[model samples]
Target chain A: MNLATKDIGQSLGRFVLTTLGVGMLLMVVMAMGGIYRGILEDATLLVNEIGTDLWIVQRDTRGPFAELSRVPPNLVHRALAVPGVKSSREFVFHTVQRERRGKPFRMAVLGLSWPSDKGDWIPLLAGRPLRQNHFEMIADASLKIGLGEKIQLGKETYTVVGVTHDMLASGGDGIGFFTTADAQAIQFDVPSEAVRLERSSRAARGTRFELAAKQPSLLEFANLPAAELPQIARPQVSAVMVSVLPGAEVQQVAKIISGWDDVSVFTRKGQRELLLEGTVEKVRRQIGLFRILLVVIAAVIMGLILYTMTLDKIHSIALLKLIGAPNSVILGMILQQALMLGALGYGIAFLAGRKLFPLFPKRVILADDDLLMLAGIVLAISVLASLMGIWKAMKVSPNEALA
Target chain B: MNTLPEANSTNSTNVSDEIACAIETKGVTKIYGSGNTEVVAMRDASMKVQRGEVVALLGPSGSGKSTFLTAVGLINPPTSGQVLIGGEMVLEGPVAHTNLRTFRRNHIGFVFQKSNLIPFLTAVENVQIAMELAGESRGAARRRALELMEYLGVADRASNLPSALSGGQQQRVAVARSLANRPSVILADEPTAALDGERGRQVMDLFAKVAHEQGAGVIVVTHDHRSLDVFDTIFEMEDGLMHRAKKP
Candidate 1:
């Protein structure tokens, strides 16, 4: 029998226990890697799902996901006027919290103009998209909101028209889609009392200015009906998402929009990169640090275990030496046992991670490529860890067998 | 059929052309430390044994009997000595004329007091590994191992691990392993020290049988004098010095 099989046979319980321990450590490593991948996946899901060719945001901003970007709602017209632009829609993005059944739920609220196919940004899993723009909303399936349920936001109650799957914002929050007019009313409409207070405060200030100038006409200007007064609060949108015509260059359209002084533009690729690297960079580094720490711990643990096992078998090693077995033979035995341990441990970790990762509160995406990469790393670690045992076995004197 | 090389004719001057010496040592010395703190473990030890001869080594504790056995086994090379196996000089005064590991694998076998079987392997595998190390095919090695186990009277226990075997059975497997490579000489250090008198005598007789039947020279270091009659010759060691004993 080969040394690895023989040694494992001799102490099956210890071998299994050690493998289980290493498996747990490897599970942490796999989970950490999955978390990093999950962050990247979540960061780009919205951008990928939207399938927009260009994003026009407030100038000097990194787009809606990375920074606060607000552009006038009228920017959609300008974006549509750009050459090669096939469709443009004003998109509003914000975070909101609502109490449902006495439980608080948070979600990203995305406002898109209707009658434009831009409402198809989120794929519906059940029910139909918003046919009426006034008080209908589509909720992410993760929010657990059922169809036909009414939810209150600000001063309005809206019916859940449809449910969508995997529609999440960069921060891993579920999304709710609303018509642009409803969203603007919910976001920008002030309470009637507050409006009255503002109007009175402005009229009093105007009266004081008129008395100082000895002209009562300024009060008339201030007393003008609220509708007759210039509309000071216009609808503001987070960004204008634009789609290019078939065969049209996306970069060309982005360049045309970039000429606007009030807004900057990003191609789809640039927006995806900004979402991944700029928005989730810290989380990636944190998960990376955790992954590195777990790997080092795994290597140290395997090294110590292999070294201890070698020390325990020093006599057998010396006997092998005395019997004229070459150093390569003994070294092969140690290396084989180490690799076997690593393989078994990785198998256990992979199975356990697959079963357990979904239960984690945060998104954990275990990709096939990540699994293969981790396997290679574990194999390399096993080989390097066995060196300590090999060194000790090599130093065993054959004469010790005679003693 | 065995593939081992025949003994050189030039080194068989004292024997018939057909009977060659299996092992010859000339003034082998093993010294530990140096100067005032130096200790001699073996001094000017010399001997010869023909093929198919079984020799017993008798000594008191700390008399360097193990030292001589290890030195002759090519494990602990002597500080100053020359060693020849099958009439070929393999070692001279701490230097080796060939790769010692390969030389030992082809020419020598060793059995220890404790049987020292690899606990994880069954009796057959323990024996088979020795042959495999000498470049035998796995099938051939396994066939040879079973043959040796049968010859050593442990064939029924061949599939059992060392832990499941009795003390005498373990020693039999160890002896079978020693014979696996078809070596010219076998060196056993206190091979019967852990057995009772009856079991010990049986193990010693097995060594004698192996030597005579396989045409191998055997040297066994032991404190048991009751089995001395099993050996063709007897040597005694005292305080690192060796001399021929008066044969009974």
Candidate 2:
């Protein structure tokens, strides 16, 4: 007669309910790990999918994701001049927030090197990538923008021509792809009133200069529309993405680019590390601490539960002892029950997670082998917890039954 | 071997009682605590029971009747004394001549006040476990359990749990369990306390029948006076001392 199983059978309803409560607690612990992985995947989605062999950013900065990066658009040409560099693309990234139906519509915007990189590499769920440079854009499915819908940002409206899924930035916002000119147009967009103020201010400045007063032609140049200006420098890009030739050495090409004074070059892997180590490090630690605390809490609860169960069996145990039931019988009983509880609880957590994980606001990615390690930990915990009950059981003198 | 109510099917020790003595205690004493906190629970108490005899140790609460019974039962060893079972010296003053637990399992049985059945086990399993603890094989143990259950008139309720049985039925099952190992000595402490008058009398009658028919020495410590006529001999205790009640 296996005493533990027999006892559990007698109070199956209570046993199942208790196991369910433990399973739910363990489920959160399991999901915590998946959520942390989801954050990592979200943080590096762009870096992994952009098909870049090298990233050229501003000197002394980690960007374009970990820190702000600004390099002149001509860096693409400079990178292409390297021996192993086969292709180069201009990269621009920023976030835009606009109003939609009285709610905030926030998207992490990326500018594709249009006509060369028309977002053909993007995994589209619907519609098509940017067909024209001026107004066509590709939006993530999470942005809630349907194909052919129009969204206005910065005094200009862009039509959503393509939709992608799970293409989120590190900050968990949806990403939209647009042409370099259009994205820059939105990034530097200013109100017409501010532009008017700027032109008048420039006309005043031109009149105040003694040289400008004598020439008067310089004043005519200043009064010309800001678009026709000749003294302004070209707008800078966030970074330059370089893809190496199939048979060439990437490190050799990177070594050549590293010699440049104004920019820093990084291999694709370094960029991903910067994003993971710098972007989401704290969130990972916070979730990791929570998982540890929860595991400790689970061990404590299991200990107390086993102790109380043994306490409840005092009378019967005393009687069994008096009848010459050995210490082995009592020890076997408590140990077996603890293992059953741990094994069954893990099963419930996994079965329950399968039904509920997808409903979470973030992705929860759990694989089967995760249970192998967790099950070992749970089994060890069960044995340690059952020791408390076994200790209490061994002290019960058979003489108590005579009382 | 005759089955059910004969009580002879399960034991090799079920022989005529003429030549063997079952239980004998000489000057047994049990003390608790030490120094200023020292208290004596049983003092110089002695009793003898022959094979096939039923004896009752009657006393008020705290009168050492239970102390003497536990000492002879080899559970709470006495501070000073000799305890013999089946004509063999087993205990001498808080010490044992053999492995106490194994010796007890093979030789003695116990039934408690509340019918102390393991709640999770069904009626038959409860009886079967006692023999299993004595190293009996599961098949043989189960067969004997069923025989004892039938003999105790509880075989019909073999599948029912202890909680589903009434107080009287529970005590009957407890008796069947005590008989499972075919012990030479059966000790009971207030075995019928939970039952009504008629049920209590019936249980007392069952103890006497087990003693006379099975040739096992039986000792019952109880305050129930309604069935004193059922015992073959009676001992009384007061303040750690024992006195045989003189025959009327």
Tens digits of per-residue lDDT, candidate 2, A221-297, equal 76666558868657789999999999998888888988989889889999999988898999878987887888889
**Stretches of model 2 off by over 4 angstroms after superposition:** A209-230, A367-370, B1-6, B9-14, B87-89, B135-140
Candidate 2: Cα lDDT at B155: 88
Candidate 1: tens digits of C-alpha lDDT, residues B70-166: 8888887999989999999989989999898889988898888999998888999999999888889999899888887877778899999999999
lDDT of every predicted structure (CA atoms): 0.86, 0.87
Clash pairs, model 2 backbone:
none
- Cα shift from native, residue A310, model 2 (Å): 2.0
Give residue B174's error in model 1 in angstroms.
1.0
Error of 1 at B19 (Å): 3.4
DockQ of 1: 0.58
Candidate 1 structure quality by residue, lDDT tens digits, A1-403:
4877887898999999999999989999999999899889888987888888999999999979999899987888988888899999888888877677888888888887786843665678988888887889999988888999998887789899999977788777888889877777667667878877878887788766647369766666665546467645466788999999999999888877788788899988999989877889988898899899989999999999999989988888888888889999899999999999999999999999989998876688889999999999999999999999999999999876665
Query: DockQ numbers for every candidate?
Result: 0.58, 0.70
CA lDDT for candidate 1: 0.86
